[model samples]
Target: MIDGDDVGKRFAVVEHPMQPRALAAPMHRHHREDEYSFVLEGRIGAMLGDTVVIGNPGNLIFKPREQWHTFWNAGDTPARVLEIISPAGFEHYFRELGAELSNGPPDPQRLAALCARYALDMDMSSVPGLIQRFGVRFPGGPSPAPQ
Candidate 1:
């Protein structure tokens, strides 16, 4: 995905389908960069600390470095978003990790280790509900985090 040192300031545009499953970005907190995202269509629900904020089109969400956050499409339709990152090298992590997971299924143990290395932690209690709602599951284990 991204190399920690090479991330620089840049803008990224993405158009993702609005699927029913509640997608997620593994729990993570950046140590050196800040990120902002603008929704162009539909609504997105973001987790910033213990709060869940619903962001619709024209809404912007910000995550300062070292704050844990995650986001997902919250409505029944697809969404488009513009993601902005300050100090660009972080894209390497996203790209590399994405490529790694793009193949077949993900290895939960490996993913958990990777998340730990990146200061990311995911909660598993909500997982069964997620699967009930989304019909998706990770390949490795029920809870990937180290006990």
Candidate 2:
């Protein structure tokens, strides 16, 4: 609910509502901002590098910049989390991504460019394996083959 500018760019708060079994994004890492997610409802499962952890309500998960990580709603019910991104800026990436998705499926090149602009690295190839291994659902239909 708080923008980076309002907080002098030290941090920004964004609320994320996750559907049951939803995977938030493909495996990815940020080069500029660290994120801390506080679980507000339901369970959240996250993978930081090769380590996996689960957080329930009242739990906070830390994801440092440059770490390959991803998180998903790990429950049968809806989930919500408050994300705090430090040194600001990265929250805008979510806004842009949402707008792109609103148009329909995103073009791979455009998505790549967007991520690059945000100093983010994504592993689209990891989607299928994550879905199968964790029983989570990626937003777009059909899993892409691992490259």
Candidate 3:
């Protein structure tokens, strides 16, 4: 992860593995930040606004702030993507989530509190359908955002 503190608040980058048939995140939107995903290997499926498309390595997909979006591995093989979130700082959300998870399964209240502190809006309502329709894996539990 690229710490925002070291980047003049420009952006933060995170590299994530997208296991075969795995969804990176549930449908959600950041009202204060924009995110772009650059595929590093294999293939990925993404929903940006109303368009849903499959992206291959080297493809860069944008999910602007205030837009609901999600991405998943769209192939039989593992994939990877580099996520860049602009204006920095949201990386702290992912960091705290890891810390909170070290104890055990996530507590709904703590997860909610974390989301509130990060000003993130995440919805798991469409997760089941997404997993079914896209044949993607959902990180079992009430966790709304990606790891």
Residue 75 lDDT in candidate 2: 88
Top TM-score model: 2
What's the lDDT for all of these models?
0.61, 0.93, 0.84
Stretch of 10 with least lDDT, candidate 2: 138-147
Candidate 1 residue lDDT tens string, 1-147: 233353333533333444433456544577766778788888877778767788889999997887877677776666666666665645555665677788856577876766666554556455554444434333343532221
Evaluation by TM-score, superior candidate among 2 and 3? 2
Q: Which stretches of candidate 1 lie over 4 Å from their true place?
A: 1-18, 108-147
Local lDDT at 17 for model 1: 45
Candidate 3 per-residue lDDT over residues 85-146, each given as its tens digit? 89898888888988988988689899889888877887868788787777777766332224
TM-score for candidate 1, please give it. 0.67
By lDDT, the best candidate is 2
Clash list (residue pairs), candidate 3: none
* TM-scores for all predictions: 0.67, 0.95, 0.89
